[model samples]
Target: QPVTEEPSALAPPAAKPKSAVFYRHLRLDFPAIVRGEGSYLILDDGRRILDASGGAAVACIGHSDARVGEAIMSQIKSASYCATLLYTSTVCEQLCRLLVDSTNGQMARAYIVCSGSEAMEASLKLARQYFLEKTQPEPQRTHFIARHQSYHGNTLGALAVGGHKSRRLPYEPILSTNVSHVSPCYAYRGKKAGESDAEYVVRLADELDAEFQRVGPEKVCAFVAEPVVGGALGAVPSVPGYFKAIQAVCRKYGALFICDEVMCGMGRTGSLHAWQQEEGVFPDIQTYGKCLGGGYQPIAGILASHEIIDTISKGSGAFVTGHTYQGHPVSCAAALAVQHIVAEENLLANVSELGPYLGELLTKRLGDHPYVGDIRGRGFFWGIELVEDKATARPFPPKANVAMEIIDLGLKGADYSVALYPGSGTADGVSGDHVILAPMFNASRAEIETIAD
Candidate 1:
């Protein structure tokens, strides 16, 4: 018999990539991701991990799409960055045009911004500017009523308007003083014990209305909310008629309904915009990000309808805002390419197709598990609530580190390398935890299975 060649142990196993900085959290030995293809990250150690959360649901069309790359290169060849004040590039204008057209030409125009936070800030400022343009300069129109357990951004103003206590806790001292939060329409934990869905929605709407009244309706400029609550409370969507009711109340108070679809918009909710499916409700101001550029570039925007734009354009003749990178040439080109692919390739239909399938798989696998409590979401975005006890709906103590454990398990398990984002204090504002799975927009059925498993 031929002697088997002894395995050479010359090469020691490679070291795992480490996080750049660690303050007090766990010492993480993160993998060095060298490349991304479709819906997977290729680590330096030759391991392939399915990107489940996409670094917080930003990778919509998946990695390394040539169209987006070419577009970026094209813009780079032309000009990488241009001052928004002095010039408006074709790429930015076209990106806006595509967005407005996709909204069925209902939207007036897009205010390009660098991040979701910037867009939210623009939304806030634009609402104020709109009032000034309309000659209804109510100084009292300064308060913002947003939903609890929702995330806007990490920036100061967005964080202030956000209701995520954990994100806001550290900066509470310096955050804005003009914002107040109301209960989110999170039915799994927020809906009343015996109330019908409609009744629960009505009551929540009433609660929001009451908050506005308490703040003085004339003083409030906008009511902000993610059509689907994001990482702060998992992918929790409002019950049917909830948005309609909220919209009605906003109209009643003459406040701008600012829908922050940052996490849920741009086809994440199986529609181009989440509000499009909600009957009888269209936001006067809407912010979008993440999937807007399909993760091809850092692009976010605020959409103003004809009413707001006409008011601003005629009254002020200029929006009171500016950003050096507001409409960068390369970013806009990448975004334009991404949006074009999303439409030309019909990826939104894919989102609608795979979103429910992923939901079903998550429910079937974890719904009956003792640790799993609720499975809720829409489109490709979904969330899983973990409970220590289903009967009591009691959450694992924050010290237990439930969601982080699952994430570690996922990384360890060869079946998948999907990420699990942990949300603390999801219930009420001080308790409850969840995991969100927002796969790529173009993920196939098999990729979805790998992610779910």
Candidate 2:
């Protein structure tokens, strides 16, 4: 007689090999993405996932573009590395020129870096240094004012300036004390029941002004904000005249207005810079990344206004900060190629034409759903906020992990295959949830339909 086998249920699960890589979620196993084609990612298991969020709105042109790859290789063959202090490459100059030209002289200088965090860090340092270099130096100007529910980056300096509550919780003890927070221009939650757009703008602007006064206006260096907030608040755009009002407050205090376009700039909002869409709201120091390199290379930078650059040039004759990988040749080449493609292909036109359609589709599809609290965004970037109670706009508790759950299901569910960017703490920086849908700038109408569907 054959030996009787133990029941399958009685047998222990096979021991899997432990992964060597430290993941963001230690207990979860991530799917391996083998390659990308157009708007989809090909996983190792052979499933094609529609890249709806472009990997945090970075892949504006989509993945694996031959042109960008060629540019990167060409730059590598010529020169990949250089000491930024001792030398600067032609590619770096070209990239900087392209950025400054895009700003149409509003931004006079560009300082390249490896990520948005570095750009923001540089922006903060440059703001401080600018004050020190002024003809009448205000050494007392050590404070920075930023909006609540804002996310700049992960570096300590960036984190200190950021107001995302959950992201800052763990590092609160170490974050700088020089930064203070103000209310973000979130109409869905922040606006009063009977308030008009103009009224809301005034109220928020007054709050910012009061904060500056509270902090002692003369001691403030800058008022930092994202024209269209990204992860922290799920692609929330300020109402009309919001930026102008706030900029006035900054101007009144003689504080620089630093716009962080890390997730919403570079044609992601149908403008080279998000502030360009806001009338008379030019930033003194602007930080941009994400779509800057179109995910082909790791690159980011800050565009400084003429005043700040002139101040530094006259006083220090040099920026006080520097990074080892600043102005890396290959990264600059990749970014330059990406920006050129964006311009040559007229992808901004695509974004401008299709962005409203995408929004309309999302509203038609999910607007009535009890869970969809709000839908807001511009250009290729849009967000669907989820709520537990539509009547009250009540957010699910943090333990529910609603946003991540939806994202995980989208990735692994049998009915659909899509990748979305998730955000938490949307309601009060701890309980609200939202999912962003940021298709590539070159995404087709058909792809937009698929994403909305």
Candidate 3:
């Protein structure tokens, strides 16, 4: 029997929304974003704020791209949702093929997901599953090794693997106990005096080796890291041969190497893959997002090496995970269009050409500023660390919220009309302030200068 209730004639009027749509910050009054243009966000109040950080470096191709919208609409007109468990879509196949081809066959398979966090979570699961599927069958290999002061994602699985103290503080008691963290190869703060780059690489490699030994190498599944430290470390890149050294250690310990390029991959670092720019560094599994879909439809994915995929295919005959929207057709269509634009416009060249120029300009403009401590990055990604004492590289206390204040000043200050990425807890995982500048990959010289000024 079905019961239907008619609306009461005397029903009280519905209460107001109470300002619906929960925001990231409950106390702060956020702006209403009505529209976005080329490298700019339009507010409901008619303010046009320049987007200098690409909204956490997500808008690689900028916003209001009609081509992407059209592609999305085309797919939506066809069909929006398909149960992927029993079927597949052309757009999804095309996107996967394009991703594999982009890797030049280095990565043999692609698992399309909805966000970077999903991609990373998949990577972690795949790595552990791979060990189980191998002929050796390492059921005991359950632990993961990551770096301290790094951020993977917010989900429980990703959060467990991440080492950001502030973000993990609330969930520390509930996070997975199988993950351990090692020191990040940060030259600015981690390197000892008088140590050469080669020596530093060796030293870090030794640290990884020691960690594996301490954790019982047979119990470890993989070592995960971000090729270029993103917001957690304020765009810090490792020295030459750093990754090669770390990868070697992982190989020596029978552990897989996983690189989290969610915030730094897919041409954000000038190269299509950050690992491609490195001389001899590569990953068994890699995660990418943000720029992968250019914030169009919230898409991300993981690329796996042939060896890893073959093991699973031969053993379980299928992956042990499923998501209703794992390969959404509309999202794939939008990402495909965004990727096509990235290629058709040859934006990578633009990124390569302008990256150094942007760095040079930032150095020239803010290098001598008293509060500026260190400026380091590569390609279109750059960061400016603010300090209390430049000579000592002393960061402002966490309570000061220097980075957030700079972001606010840039957005509302009469002098500088721009939006920058604010980063905190960059020093010792508790007290540090820095701002990141990740302009659009297709930014013109004038726009770059504007960001610098």
**Clash count list over all predictions:** 1, 0, 0
Candidate 3 lDDT over 1-453, as tens digits, reads 111113242232354234566767787767666678888876655566788899888998998899899999999999898788899899999999998998867888998999888988999999989988783633888999999998999898999999887788889999999999998988887888899999999999999899999999999999999999998989888999999999999988889999999999999889989988878887999999999899998899899999998988888889888788999999999999999999999999999999999999999989999999889898999999888888777888887899999998887756557889999864353336889989998899988998888
Please provide, for model 1 over 1-453, each residue's C-alpha lDDT reduced to its tens digit, 9 standing for 90 to 100. 111112232222455345676654666566566668887776665656677887777888888888789889989998888888889988888888888887776689988887999999899889878876675544557788988767888889889999877778899999989999888887878776898999998899899889987999888888999888888888988899999999999999999999999989998989999999899888998999998887778889899989988876777689988988898888889888888888899999999988999999988888899888899999988889888888878888877778888877876665556665666654342447788888888889988887776
Cα shift from native, residue 286, model 1 (Å): 0.6
lDDT of 1 at 187: 87
> Could you tell me the TM-score of candidate 3?
0.94
Off by over 4 Å in 1: 1-26, 136-138, 426-431
- Tell me the TM-score of each prediction against the true structure: 0.93, 0.95, 0.94
- Shift in Å, residue 192, candidate 2: 0.8
Best by lDDT: 2
Ranking by lDDT: 2, 3, 1
Clashing pairs in 3: none
Estimate, for each residue in 67-114, the C-alpha lDDT of model 2 and write its tens digit.
Answer: 999999989999979898899899999999999998877989899999
Clashing pairs in 1: 140-219
Taken over the whole model, the C-alpha lDDT of each candidate is 0.83, 0.89, 0.87
